[model samples]
Target: MQPPSKTTPFSLPVDSDHKATKFRPFTISPPHMRAFHLAWISLFSCFFSTFAIPPLLPAIRRDLHLTAADVGRAGVASFAGSIFSRLAMGPICDLLGPCAATAAFSLLTAPAVLSASFMSNSTSFIVIRFLIGFSLANFVACQFWMSSMFSNNVVAVANGVAAGWASVGSGFTQLVMPLIYSFLINTVNLSSSTAWRVAFFVPAFFQTVTALMVLAFGQDLPDGKYKRSSNITGQISKENAFTILLNGLKNYRGWILGLTYGFCFGVELTTDNILAQYFYERFNLDIKTAGAIAASFGLANIVSRPAGGLVSDEMGRRFGMRGRLWSLWVVQTAAGLLCFLLGRSNSLWGSVLVVCCFSFFVQAASGLTFGVVPFVSKRSLGVISGMTGSGGTIGAVITQLLLFSGSSGNYMSTQTSISLMGILMVFCTLPLTLLYFPHSGGMFCRPNYPPTHQQHYDHLLQCQ
Candidate 1:
């Protein structure tokens, strides 16, 4: 066997004193707190805007007199915009750096959200919401930035924090938006139209504030921080970028992971977006009760993500087990079964418990899904992430379509459809377990081949 290469991409030089020097200024002085605070603040802002649209769907529907199909169509529009924006933004992030890209997108998203307040018809509403999704596509930029700043050892925690914060946005909207709506109706004496407008305005104001923070505090990451293929040549040409993305698509591992994400997120969006409506119809619960129950998913997701990462790391160290992909499949399958059972039950409290358990598993799976991303292609993390995220968006849109058409504006029909989707989700994981986990090792390391071969291409495409 050849001697171990001194410059293995996976290996990092250990420096005991280097850690001290790297953290000395931050630990000894309080100034480092600024970076932490700003980072989290920016993250929270992104999270808030990310979730703001879903929770307000009911309010928008009622105020605009839109049908359930209209609502679904609007969601599709927004997701389509997000998909397109991510495709463009991924390469831009790789070229321009995440800081400038995030700032630009954040500023652009603010105006889109603000303009949403003025929408009067479904056509205008759909257009504006799509624009909002396009602008808020800065989320990909933020993730790339975080990956560059934190080392691999701490990357799990950093990513978990960002994801957890994003999940919290749902709860924040649930807790605050209804109250704001009530106040607008009761105190401000506004019409339903204006009340919903104010709700959009609230997130817009916060988004603008976050944009300013990003502009002031965000910094470009140092070059050559993350892993990339050594054989990558040329100066990040546009052709090179497209080739990287195309390679990821051709790679079976990437598409398999993407499919897994698509199914899981499809099920997740179905349950989350429609949970309140399901409870309200099935159990005769009020909107408030339904909102509280639905909010549990986000709360559980936020808690489960970091826990999943910790567990993955511990298992890897102790048992040499890198079964995260399989584990997620199992978890989602179990959750699907629980959801089916919950749908069959009549007791409100019993349904809530089952739903909570389902949420926990789904969230855990969510965390684990992303936990494997950095391992896929350290160089092409951003573009790969965007591609996978786009798949999830497609899943979400499909789920929305199913919910829309099958519901027929009837509650019982919707529940039945949702239960069937859950069952389908359970089976979706089987192929993932058999195909993905067994081959995960290939994803973690670069292929050994001649530089001129297409099969040996470097993964890094862009930062933004």
Candidate 2:
């Protein structure tokens, strides 16, 4: 069977016959819905395979006999591996094309994730986990795919839904992995040790399956369904990859936005891993309870992050470029304050409530950051995506170092450190609203881009 026609697969109406079509839930039809649907799965799988470790931390620590700091280091190592690798994802995705890149990450990472089933020692387990981080580069590809399919006016909403939905896996895994592990033990009669190892089979299988499905069924462009021309163009030159990388990193806005993302998404990555343990220690709860509470942090991303993007989209209409910037600052600043308040809370439920609030703003900030990312430069979306995506991992690496370095990392010490990190997040982001980008479409004092769409492939295919 052939792929569907890409000329606005969704039977939705277009405002201009010569411009890109806009899709909203109310007006969405087939097959654009098909592309949008699968794109989120690509992103969901990237994180599902990469972060599958944290939700299983209790089993991981018991099987490996690791200390708390050792667990923290293991999580840090995963982020450390991703910091630079994610930067490479953009150019690589552009070079390989998003469809190929998405499928490739799934196929490539499956073995590494599945290998956890046979690990004999902490060293091997940690090494395998670190390698899994490489799959996170798929995130750049997923975002770039959305940018290609949607109009600029609704891109933020599209990105937020895609990212927000993908992020749910973190929390869902937290709530579910324990159940999966238990099912393996009780139903299959596997030993507790073996159950943990066998549990990884789930992520490995899902990862591979999702990849094949996307490659087989997904479309790369809107004007033509399942076209391979862009994929062929991606392979034409290795030199093109380096050029894209350099151009992406050179954008000062990418750097600032990346840093801001470091505070939100990066912190979320670290928090996802640590939250389970933190709750276990701070509230003296069992691993199951702690993991469930931690899952709540990620669960909020489904709605909160989209709210951020929707807010940015609305702000852009009212305030232009500054609106996106303003939304980011406000959400992030609120998140910073929530972090401090969370640290000071005296009761367990009190802290958990604050954490839910914190989760909302932090995840929303992530959506807002990406809302602005595409506007940085159309020619370099892949590069910018990688650069900004890496920022979150970079932030996780730094946060882990600073938070765990000087302290024994007890509950109080951890809270105090996070509060300080919150202060730092605000200070770091303040200069961004004042900065500007001119090349993409702005002035020195203000950065703004008029939202416009193309009827045919342009920014994505113009990679020469």
Candidate 3:
């Protein structure tokens, strides 16, 4: 299929006399729905491994005789691996397609995680964790696969649903880890080291299972379905991937979206990964309590992501505005402030409410951030997504470091550092919202050129 010509906004060349022609709507089947379910499960498994480790840090530290600073360094190493892998996987996905890439990367993840299970020291653990970070980049490939399979109108919702489910992995680990720990201690009469090994092994086993599932059942869509043409006149090179990457970077829309993602990620990571440890130390809470509180963030994420997408889509139709993106930024900034205030509050209930509120807006912001990606460059969705995702990972890396170094291996200092980061996030919201909404037709509000009647029909059928 030829690429849509760069014509006037929302105009596509067609045989005017053929306007009356009836076109059969494309329909998805039971198999396709099954594929989507498995893909989401695979993605959830991947995320469980990626996020489950952070909450276990205090236990790992106590068991392994490690320092708070060392734990933070481990986070830095993990996110650093994510940064590089995101960059590498983007082009790989664009070239090889999402299914093969997802399976390949997921299979690689199993061993990286399994290696962590046997680490004897902090250095070995960090190295294995970094590799695990690199392997978990398969989540990006999953995103590409889901986006390609779904129609544009509902792509945000699909992404949201996957993201929401994936967040559950963290919550699941939080809820299940204690049980697993208890089982190892009481039933198996295992040592602490052996119990930790079991925790790591569970994710590795699931990752292996998910990889086999993908290899067996995953199907690649025909190239014509989603691959954008590379032949933009004097603009993008067909063979040079770097040229395409550079061109995407040059686009103003891409940078704006990337910045929005970066800011949101920085704040979210600070709270999700670092704050639990900070709270435990500062308030003298037990490891289990801190983990439970942190798990609430995931609970909020599971609910808010789909709500954000549904609200965004509805608002887009009613107001002809991309209120989802802009509104989320403003709301998330307020949530960050509430989190900062919670850090200062001595009341436990106040802190919990603040954290829950923060989680709600942060997850909503995440959905809004990804919701705009397809609109940026329909042809180069994977590459564009990779760049933005890389930016977010970079933000995570920086925030992890800031929280780490500022902690100075002290509990009070860590809490202070986190609050300061939250303040910075508030400032970040201004530029992001301004850049994201230019007073022109905003990202999600802009009419899709070359109207996808088949997509609309599919959405309509789903609605019915």
Candidate 4:
């Protein structure tokens, strides 16, 4: 049995490389779909743990006597913790495989999620938030797992569906946290402080259970466990992890995609932190009401991101890489405009409508970004995924520290900061125009050598 060549239009059932040509998301059978289910669900629990605090911030602020400055710094610290972890997770994935990487990281961070319940002061609160944030690196593992399980043709959709479903955890927390808090206070008769504190136990438990599930059920590659190659001396040095790391770093496309991801996914992270507070203060909504509205932004990922992947694939079938780039540019541009409008809207209803629309485009842009990622360099996929994934946290850190961080004393008003972020997002989309490949040309040009039906996947072989 041989791997599919440059001219093979479709793969055989369970091809020699063990990658699946067709994607059947509903089925949870072994190899492809089973990995897909575990990958997204594990990351979803991480997302749940990472963001469990934001919706409860109002009650937390009063109980802990936290000022605006303290809250701002905590937000920055949460995103900051993930930045380095995301960069490191890439090489770790290459060395250890996504299954081991995800399971280990999840277990390591689960205690941090539980620790959030014990923090009494702002300092301890900030530290616990930082530790819990390390789980976000699971995102890199999720993307890496999907790339390993699916073939080139369906990889975009696989990546999109996996990531999109996992991101729903952000919204799920927004909606569920408030309800749990209400249940504790109303039904259990616990005080507000105790209710919020005890609520932490739920996500912590959820995260721990999911991590164990991955360890017991998940496989690294489609066929089985990841095996390392041996050198002439029979020492296990077959794949030089450093060379894989360096090769991915050398590719210019990864950097461009990383920068672009900052605005879309980074903005999403920043919003997840601030949105409930925004509606609470600006609109005078109750805690539960504000959380439900905030959840809408994240829940939109269910359809929006997959739509972006679907549209990108359809465009690629017709216009190759150029179509993918153009669709990304257009959709992201709309997201920026809506973001600006969201800040400027005066009424609560109007703002909510704008936010829902903004969520769609911004999340779709994330899906579109990853749709191009797997094609960058198959050999260095983990490294490239790490670079792009880290870029999102970096973007959130900058957005938080400079614009949303009230501790800075010179930070802009929240509304003004959001509008300015929109302007920055528009500028970020410009880099997508600069990306090009050998057989598939860029935004403004046509390919010098047009590809045949099977040659469309040739970019999987080389970065250029």
Which number leads on lDDT?
Answer: 4
- Give the 10-residue window scoring lowest on summed lDDT in candidate 2: 439-448
Per residue, candidate 1 scores C-alpha lDDT tens digits across 174-247 of 55666677788889999867887877788878877877876676555433322233324634344466765665
TM-score of each: 0.79, 0.88, 0.82, 0.93
lDDT of 3 at 261: 69
Ranked by lDDT, the better of candidates 1 and 4 is 4
Tens-place lDDT digits, model 4, residues 5-87: 56643333445567887788898878678899999999999999988999999999998888889999999999999998998
Better-scoring candidate (lDDT), 2 or 3: 2
Query: How far is 446's C-alpha from truth in model 3 (Å)?
Result: 10
Instruction: Name the lDDT of candidate 2.
Output: 0.76
Q: What tens-digit string does per-residue lDDT give for candidate 2 at 165-201?
A: 8888888888878888888888999998988888899
Ranking by TM-score: 4, 2, 3, 1
Off by over 4 Å in 3: 1-32, 222-240, 406-412, 433-440, 443-464
Q: Which 10 consecutive positions of candidate 3 have the poorest summed lDDT? A: 16-25
Instruction: State which candidate, 3 or 4, has the greater TM-score.
Output: 4
Candidate 1 has its poorest 10 consecutive residues by lDDT at: 16-25
